[model samples]
Target chain A: MAASSRRDGGAAGRAKAERSAWVLLTPMCLLMAVAFILPVGLFLLYSFYRFRGGRLEETFTLETYWRFMTDELYLITIYDTLQLAVLATLLCLVISYPLAYAMWRMRSPGLQKLIAFIVFAPVLVSVVVRSYGWTVVLADQGPVNFILTRLGLTSGPVSLVYNMTGTVISLAHVFLPFVVFPILASMLRLDPTLREAAEDLGASWWKTFRSITLPLTLPGVVAGAQICFTLSLGSFVTPAILGGGRVLVLPIQIYTATSDINWPVAAVGGLCLLVMAFIAVVAFGRLSQYSEAV
Target chain B: MAARIARAGRLPAWRHLALGIFTVAAVVFILAPLVIVILTSFSAQSYAIFPPEGYSLRWYANLAAQTTFYVAALRSLILALVATAASLVIGTMTAYALVRYRPRGHSALKAIFLSPVVLPKMVLGVAVFMLVIKIGFYGSSWNLVLTHTLICVPFVIAIVAASLANFDWSLQEAALDLGSKPLPTFLKVILPQISVSVFISGLLAFVTSFDQVETTMFLMRPGESTLPIEMFLYLQRWQDPTIAALSSVLIVFAIFLLVMTSLVLGRRKITTLQTSAEPQP
Candidate 1:
């Protein structure tokens, strides 16, 4: 009889704890519902409304979506946005892989830490500052052009800024830390015994790296690529400063549409960007799963 | 055998040399822009040019005369502080509850909280802008604060929850068994353990909020902007060295933050090492 009563008391205490958990969660849930969920829902709703004569019309029309699908200008912008994102992701992976490999191979922890700090230090600075810095660095008479001219690679200054080339380069730079850290983390997590076994079997260094290290770190590559792609898709500051009016990506299109009071276009353009980001995320998620299974 | 295998796995000296050169080049690429910005800030000329025609402090003087940046900086500092404090409190509570009890659909709840990280800041800006206009809360600082808190809470929850998951619950139980109340037990025991995560998250939250431009742009009243927004607009109008001067100042501030973070992390590492070395009860 005593044991049964004590069991009942334990169940009561657990019930109380559960109740308190709900109470703790209520504020966060309420805040998210009010500030996040409602706003996003409203934004999505606006995408269906019509924009005519320089104003928004509250009619339930698919005109914006239809136009977005059919318009050549919008199609070109989407193409450019995707091209930029893909190129940036590829570039980030290319640059970060070697760097991550080097960091992983470092014998000294102190040197590794210092190198990691150097790699991550840029993240603390504002994107605007970084973008502005790139504009000067890649300008016609800037240091890069100066070097190229001096090296006789080109007789005159080359136009690196105010174009897709500059945008991609700057975006890649902005996302390098994000790419490097994940790859480095996965490299650290790798089992050394596997590599040793591969070597003991008379595999060359290159062979072991190719068959063992590369395949195991594929998840990190996918993860980093996903981040770079998604971030590049919505990147505004770098492209805005570096593109100098030539790079008409979707985020810029949305900003312009909003500034022009074309709310419907803005809303539709934003949704397109969101859709692209979502697709990249989902594709990379599957890739990572496959890589991990390998 | 292991030593032989390791030796065999090591790369040739030439390969290491090549990689070392590549690493140096990568670091240069990563740091070139920042280095140029600082160099440009010291340039006397109006245009950004290589080798900076001549050096002067005139741009710094120009930055000093611009009162707008000062006001914006102050506003950003306060806003970030308030947002960080609020998010830390609310986020810690939610993280504690989620980590301890793990109520039904906990993963879903966590996902909902962290979904903002994936949402484009531009979209969030416009969405909240529309909401504020519709609700007649336009030009309100409170709206900005609340939105910032919403944006920041996800980070805090992610960090704090991770720390809380690894917490030893037996200490709390022991305190409870000694007749201590739950609130005091949490304040005295649970908090001290997770405090480092809290501090790191708070710093991250502050930096994120302080550097925000996309979200803060749509919300701020005309003529009143955050430092980043101010600098962004300034850059749009002029590509002069004054902005570079301002950026240099901000870079110095970032360095300060970096030092602080390293100190905190270093101290925590030492403390953990010491604790692990001590004999357990």
Candidate 2:
């Protein structure tokens, strides 16, 4: 009886220790729960709230959702947001691919290291600084316009700053590193034997690249695009600064709405951005599967 | 082979020259604007110009004259430090739990934990703003700390978990069989192995938390803003060389951080090349 009692005591002690472990985890878990989960969940709920008379009505109505569907302005904003994100993401990928490839193909390790630093150094700097820099570069009197006009490319320096072109160019610059690194990682991870085999089969350099290298790195391309698209969709700072009051992405629209005390519309807009990002993630996951199959 | 070598030598003559030119152009695209900002910081005039009429240190001097900038910079520094320390402790603990303990439904819980990465920060800002207003914690520094904590936790978890996943757990078993206490076992055994990851993630969190703009924009009251929010708002009303001056200061600060971290990290390379530095479990 004493033996059984002692065994039962040990079991209880183990259970108590496990409970203590969970108890120790409580603060952080609570921090995440309260600050992250609750706020975002509440925001999702707030999208259903009714905005009336320049005030927020905390209700369960789907009026905001219905309004978003019926409203042309909202639809247009959504369309513009999608178009901007897609174009920016594509532009980033196109530039990053060659840059990453060049970095990958370099025989000299020192050069590779240098290129990597140059690619990623801007990320450590503030986005605001980079955006401000682009504003100067793409400005009417900036070096770019000066060169364009000097080359007789145009009759005058074109209106580049405070426009969509500037925003897209700046954003592409902003997200370039995110795309480049992932592709480089995949390129480095590429099995050398396959490339060697392609060479062994007497395939030319271009053919080897097309058949062996490109397919292997498609996953990286998809991964990079996913990051760029999702990030661009939610970007607030660049569009606000470089957009110069002309470009209107969802994040800016949401910001404006929230400032106006239009909680429902802001929430709905954020929801759309969130949904668009989610779809991109899902779509990329699917595309990666197809790439793997090939 | 000689023919191929000849072709390779000649190939560098034109095509590779073009390639090198393109690469240099890309680098210029990345670097020139930053160079302009740094150069403009030394301008004699208030307005931006590529070739400054003359050079002066006045803007940097002017930045020193702003008391508000100093206070805001200090506050942001302290706040980011607090958040970094807070997230490091919690994040390491949580990552350990997720890794060591085979708790049920860990993956789903992890996904939930990391959802902040995907959830738009503006949405987060507005939501937290409304929630705080309702909960009566609207203007508190804790709100900022909490929000930044949420923002930074995923990064910490990702880095630490990646490191811990690579760790050989048999070492833990060896420590335990030798009769070490769990707490001591963790500190003396586990920490040194993953210290690199912890420090890197902590560095990243500090920078990210310190650099927040849009989220902190609404969170702070007008006079009581953080540094980045202060600068962001200041930029709206002004386009003077003051910002260029401030940016140059920020550039110096970033350089200081890089130097400090390099000293701290020692042999570990700063570039985040491999997400996991060590081999995976």
Candidate 3:
């Protein structure tokens, strides 16, 4: 009889703990419901609403999605957005890999910490500030032009700012720290003994890096790339400040549409952006899994 | 440097030299924009000219005279603080629940919570704007705070969860057995251990919210733009050094934050940085 009562008390305690867990989770659930689910639902709802001339019709239709798919201007905007994201992500990888390799190879703890700090310090600064900084640095009379002119690479100032070159370069810079850290983290997780074994078996440094280190860190590369790609895909400030009224990516298009009170167009553009980001994330997730398996 | 090369294994000397040169180039690439902006802030000429002919404090004086920026900066500060505080509280509760209880489908619930991290900020921004307008809450400050909290809570949850995963629950049980209440036991036992992660998450969340532009733009009135929006708009009209001056101030502020972070993390020397980055299993 005592053992039966004890078992009943244990079951009651387990149930109580579960209740407390739900109680703890209540605020988060409510916040997500009110702020996240509701807003995203309304956003999705607007995409189905019809917009004629200057008025919005509270009706369900696929007109916006159809237009987004059929419109030539939007088709080009989508292409340009993808191009920008891909270019920026590639540039980030190219720069971050070597930098991370150097950090990983460093024997001095002080140097490692300093390098890490330098890479990450930019995160604290506003993106607007960083993007603006890029404009000046890449400007006609900026240091880049100054160096090129002095070196006789060009006879006069080259037009770098307010163009795709400037936009991609700035985006790469903005996301570099993010790209670097993940790669560095993966590098730090490498087994020193594996490299030592490769060395013992007469493998060259480059060969070992290619066969062992690079493949092992490919998951990190994918994670970092995912972040860089998604961020660049939806980037507004840098492209706007640096695009100089020329780059017509989807985010810019959405902003313009919203300003013009074309909610359908804006909503559709946002949905396209969302879909593209989701696709990239899933692709990267697959790539990450494959790399881990390798 | 030679020692570093020697430690890097049997790489050739020329290869090491190449790596060293490339590292210097990469550092320059990272720091050039920031250095140029700081230098430009002192330029006597309004337009950016590398290696300025003369220097002056004119832009700093000009920045001081702009009341709009002052107000916007203040607004951003308060908004970031509120968002950070709210996210920390909500995130901690959720994280503790997930960690301690190991609720069913907990991984799925965690993913749902962290889905915002992958969701494009621009989409979230537009969605929230539509929701607020639809519900006639467009002018309310809580909307902005709530949206920012939503953005920031993921970082807190991710970081705090990772830290809590390593926490010893036996201490909590011991305290409870000693006749302490759950709240006090958590406060006295669990919080002190995870304080460092909490602090780092709070700092990160604050920075994320403060630097928000695409997310906060449509939510605010034209005259009540955040510091970043104000700077963005100002840059569109003018290419002057006044912005450089303001950017320099922000850079200094960033340096201050970096210093504080190092000081705190220096004591702990935890690999929590990596954990914060890849909090998901």
Model 3 fnat?
0.67
Error of 3 at A120 (Å): 0.5
Evaluated on CA atoms against the true complex, candidate 3 attains a DockQ of 0.58
Estimated TM-score for each candidate: 0.94, 0.91, 0.96
| Residue pairs that clash (backbone atoms under 3 angstroms), model 3 | none
Q: List the residue pairs that clash in candidate 2.
A: none
Query: Cα miss at A184, model 1 (Å)?
Result: 1.2
Q: DockQ, in order, for the candidates?
A: 0.43, 0.42, 0.58
- Off-target runs (Cα >4 Å) in candidate 2 are A1-25, B1-15, B261-272, B276-281
User: Among all windows of ten consecutive residues in candidate 2 chain A, which has the lowest summed lDDT?
Assistant: A1-10
* Docking quality category of candidate 3 according to DockQ thresholds: medium
Fnat, one value per model: 0.58, 0.40, 0.67
Ranking by DockQ: 3, 1, 2
How would you encode candidate 1's per-residue C-alpha lDDT over B1-281 as one tens digit per residue?
A: 77866683575788898889999999999999889999999998999999788999999999999999999999999999999999999999999988887677787888777777777788888889888988999999988898899888887898888788888887877787799998999999999998788887887788789988878888999899999999999999998999889988988998998888788778343222111110100
In candidate 3, stretches whose alpha carbon ends up further than 4 angstroms from where it belongs are A1-11, B1-9, B267-270, B278-281
lDDT of 2 by residue, A20-110 (tens): 5466567778997899778888888889999998788876899999999999988888987888899899899888888888777676777
Which digits, one per residue and each the tens of the lDDT, describe model 3 over residues B204-274? 89999999998898999879988999999999899899999999999999999989998888744324566
Residue pairs in steric clash, candidate 1? none
| Predicted complex 1: CAPRI docking category | acceptable
